[model samples]
Target: MAKVFIYPATSLILSDLVARFGHEPLGAALSIRERIQTPGLESPPLQITPEDPKKGLRYAAVEVPSGVRGRMAIYGPLLEQSEAAIIVTDAEMAFGCMGCARTNELILFSLRQRGIPLLELTYPKSEEEGVQFVKAIREFLAGLQEGGS
Candidate 1:
């Protein structure tokens, strides 16, 4: 199964939809939740050693506007491991809000630079729009499954 990274990872609805379509959803919220809940690992999120915030500082060093480094630290790992990506551009705080604009730009830029299959969509407000959104995502994921771009 493809590891599809869904941006604004706090969106349970989108993440669940991705899983229903048979692909693992890679997102920061998923990792954070898993780390906090799992007993064998670190209990609180701040204690986790793998995704160090210091590394994010290194990532920011390459660019002039380095404001997003801290936030990127949390979200960048999933982006690196993803085979495909889906980003809801108009996502709200109800589903999930990316509080930082610079970080969002960096994530989008990184995804585009990767040149992998990417699906960019708007948040659906109505039932009809939601259906169409799902169809679009399904088609993109289906294409990936069939080895198409």
Candidate 2:
């Protein structure tokens, strides 16, 4: 079973990738509850403190620093012991939502430097678009599996 860190992206592409391909995908604090139902590792999801003061204390969206670190900490060892990593991101837009962009960049950079095969994808615009995205992702995975590394 290949391990894929979907990273935090718009929509639910990450989870979709995991569900469709049967790949192990790490989830953030918010997603942890949902992901627990899936048959996989029981590691805790990442949780980051929010940088926005407007959000007040105890404010942590899914894509905060803690979430990123949580994901990295939990998945880092798994990735180190595994064969590859797959990260999904919005190719069209630059991340600018507080610390989310930074976290994403770090995750992307780490995965790239680790020499894991990286596959970047743009966010889907519509239902049909989502189908296409999933198809493309699945095809990529199939190619990798068939090539036998």
Q: How far off is residue 130 in model 2, in Å?
A: 2.0
Screening candidate 1 with a backbone cut-off below 3 angstroms (N, C-alpha, C), the clashing residue pairs are: none
By summed lDDT, which 10 consecutive residues of candidate 1 come out lowest? 34-43
lDDT of each: 0.71, 0.50
What TM-score does model 2 achieve against the real structure?
Answer: 0.54
| Residue-wise C-alpha lDDT for candidate 1, range 60-102, written one tens digit per residue | 6646344366566667777777888898988656676555677
lDDT of 2 by residue, 17-37 (tens): 655776655434233233335
Best by TM-score, which number? 1
Superposed by TM-score, candidate 2 places the C-alpha of residue 133 at a distance from the truth, in angstroms, of 0.6
| Runs off by more than 4 Å, candidate 2 | 9-13, 32-75, 78-82, 91-99, 146-148
- After superposition on all C-alphas, the RMSD of every candidate to the true structure, in Å, is 5.6, 9.6
- What shift in Å separates residue 57 of candidate 1 from its native position after superposition? 3.2
TM-score of each: 0.76, 0.54
